[model samples]
Target chain A: MLNLRPCTLTWLVLVSLTLMALAIGQAGLAGWGILALLLVSTFVKTWLVAEYFMGLRRVALRWRLIMAAYLVLVLSGIALAWWLAARAAA
Target chain B: MIWIFIYAELLVFGILFLAYAFARSRNVVLFNASQLELNRTAGAVNTLVLITSSYFVVRAVAAIRADRAEACARWLLAAVGLGGVFVVVKLSEFAAKSAAGIGLSTNTFYMFYWSMTFFHFMHVLLGMVILLAVWWKARQGAYSASEHTGVETGASYWHMVDLVWIILFPLVYVMR
Candidate 1:
C-alpha cells in the first residue's frame, strides 16, 4: 500500500469476496455471516489500498473529497442494509 | 496513467464485493462450509510467495534505476520464481481437493473455492506477463531512474497482490 496502485489490489479482494458469496450463498446463515464479514474485510482493504496505493493523502483536495464521499456512501449503504435487515427480523 | 487505471479497476472489484455481500445475507451456512474447503497450509505458502515476490519486485525496480540490469533481472526472476511456486501449489491443491471428492460441485463452498482462486490465479498470470515484459524492456535499456515508471507501476500492483493474499490467508483459511 505504501507503494503504488492499491485500488488494483482492492479490486482483486473484491472479486474474491464476490465469488465467495456467490459460491457459498446456498449454504445458510453461517454463509451469510461469512459473506458479510468478507465484505467488511474487503471494504477496509479497499480503503487502505486506496489511501496507500493511490496516494490519496498526497492528492489534490477535490480528489480527496471525492474519495471520501465515495467511502461514506459505501459505509452508509452497508449500515442501511444491516439496519433494514434487523428491523425486518424484529 | 497507471494510477487512474488501477483506481478504476478497484471500483469494478468493489461493486463485485457489494454484490457478494448482498447474496450472502440471503444464506450463511454455505459460505461457512465453502470457507472450510480452503487449505490452510497452501494459503500460508501462497501468502509467503506473494510477499517474497513483492520484495523482489521492489528491489528489481531499484536495481534497474541504478543501471544494474543484471541485478534487476535477477530480482525479477526471483519474483517470477516465487510466483511460479504459487501457481504450481495452487493447481496441485485443486487436484488434491478433487481427489478428495471436494469438486466444485461438491457444495457452495467448493464453488467459491474454485471461482475465487481461479480468478486470483489469472491475475498471477497477468502479473507474470508484466514481469516478462519488464524484463525485456530492462534488457533493452528502456528503463532508467527517470523512465522506470512501467516497472514502478508494475511493482506497485505486484505488492497489492501480496497485500490481498495476506488478508485472504487469514480471512478464508484461519478465521473460520
Candidate 2:
C-alpha cells in the first residue's frame, strides 16, 4: 500500500511479458501443459490488475469476500470449460 | 472490492480466451494463415495508448482526492482522448482488413479475431461513455476529496480493459 504506484506499474509489466509469452508460446507449445501455463499466468495478471490498479485494496472485508466468492464461480466456469474442451477433443 | 470485481470479470473473459485458444489449437493451419493479415502496428500502438490512459486516470483519481478538480478533469480528458484514439484506430484497422477481404467469414482465426476485438471494442466504447459522464460530473463539482469513488471506479474499469488488450494484442497479432 505504501508503494502502490510502482507496484501497479510492475503489475502492468508482468502482464505485458505474460501476454508476449502467451502470444509466442501459442504456435510453439502444445498439449494441455501449455494451456495450463497460459491459464495460470493469465490468472496472475488479472489478480494484480484487480488488486492494485483497480483500487480494490481499500475496500472493506465483505466486499473483498464477495469478490472472492465471485472468483469461486469463475473457477467453476473454467472447470466447466475445460470439461467441454475435453469433450470436444474426444 | 472493485478491484476484486474487476478480477472476477477478468476470470470470465479469461475462460472465453482459453476457449478461443483451445479452438485455435485444433485448427492450426487455418488460423495461422488467417492471422497473417493483421496489422501488427495498430495493435502495438493501441497497447501503448491504453497503458498511458491507465496512468492518466490514476492521476485523475489522485487529483480528485486532492481537491484539484481542474487537474483531475484534464487527466480524465487525457484518458478519454486515448480511448477515442483506440476506437478510431481499431475501426480503421478493421476497415483495412476488410478491404483486403478479411471478414468474419474469412476463417476461424478471423472469426475469433473480429469477435474478440468487436467485443473488446464495445468495452472500450463503454469506458469512453463512463469517462465522459465522469467528466461531466467533475465539471459539476460532483467529486472531491472525500467522495470521488466515481473516478476511481471508472479508472478501474478502464485499466481492466487495457489489461485485456495487453493479452489480446499479442495473442491475435503476434503468436503465430
Candidate 3:
C-alpha cells in the first residue's frame, strides 16, 4: 500500500527524471537540441512537483494554471535567451 | 498567507533565473566554462535529497490526515534530517569553491551562482525551521485529522523550496 501511494509514485518518477537530467549534463552534449530536451525534461519535473507534491492537482483550476504559466514563461525566456546566443555566435 | 508567500518567493526566483539566463546569453562562452567547474554531482545529489525530503513531508501530511500524530512527527523529523544533509553538502561544496579562491566577484557566472544558490540555501534553512515547528506541534498532538492546517502549510512551503531547486539545478549546473 505504501508503494501504491501517489506521492510515492511521484517521487519515483522525479528521481528517475533527475538521474536522466544528470546523465544529460554529464554527457557533454551541446547545441540547441540538447538544451531543448533538457528544458522539456525540466518542465515535466517541475510540473510533477507542482501537481503532485504541492497538491495543486486537487486545487482549483486557476491555481494550477498559474503554476503552469510560471513554468512556461520562465522556460521560454531561457530558451529564447539561449537561442539568441546561438544565433549571435553563428 | 503561505500561498501568498509562495507566490512572492516564486516571483523573486523567477526574476533571478531570467536574469541569470540573460547574463549567460551575453557571455555564453564564459558561462559555459564556469559552469563546468561546478560539482554537478553535488547539485544532483542535493536535488535528490530535497525531493526525498519533500516526499517525507507528503507522508507526514498523510499521517496527520489519518490521525497518526506520532507518525506525522516521525516523518517530519526524517524530512528535517534530510534537510541537514542538504545543508552539509551545500556548505562543503561552497567551502571547496572558496578553497579554490572562488568568490562572488570571480565572474558573472560565479556571481549568479553564489547569489542564487545562497539565496535558495537560506530558504532551505527557513523551511527546515518551519517543518520543525510543525513537527513540534505534531509531537504534542496538536494536529488532528480534522485540523491539520499547520502541517499542510509547512508542507506547502517545503515543497516550494524543492520546486525552486528543480529549476535552479538544471539552469545553473546542468543546462550549459
Strongest candidate by lDDT: 3
Model 1 CA deviation exceeding 4 Å by range: A1-90
How do these models rank on lDDT, best leading?
A: 3, 2, 1
lDDT assessment of candidate 1: 0.62
Comparing only chain B with the true structure, the TM-scores of all models are 0.85, 0.94, 0.99
Ten residues in sequence with the least summed lDDT for candidate 1 chain A: A22-31
Best model number under DockQ: 3
Query: Could you give candidate 2's per-residue lDDT for residues B1-176 as a string of tens digits?
Result: 56666767677676666666667656766766776667666777787677677778878888998999989999999989999999999999989988888888877778889888998999999999999899889989999999998888888889889778766775567544
Q: Give the TM-score of candidate 2.
A: 0.75
Two-chain DockQ for each candidate model: 0.09, 0.18, 0.84
Tell me which of candidates 2 and 3 scores higher on TM-score. Answer: 3
TM-score of each: 0.67, 0.75, 0.98
- Expressed as tens digits, the lDDT of each residue in B2-103 for candidate 1 is 656655654554454444444444444465556666666677667656755766776787687787877887888888889899999999998888888887
Candidate 1, RMSD to the unseen true structure: 7.4
lDDT of 3 at A2: 56
Q: After superposition, how far is residue B27 of candidate 1 from its true place, in Å?
A: 3.2
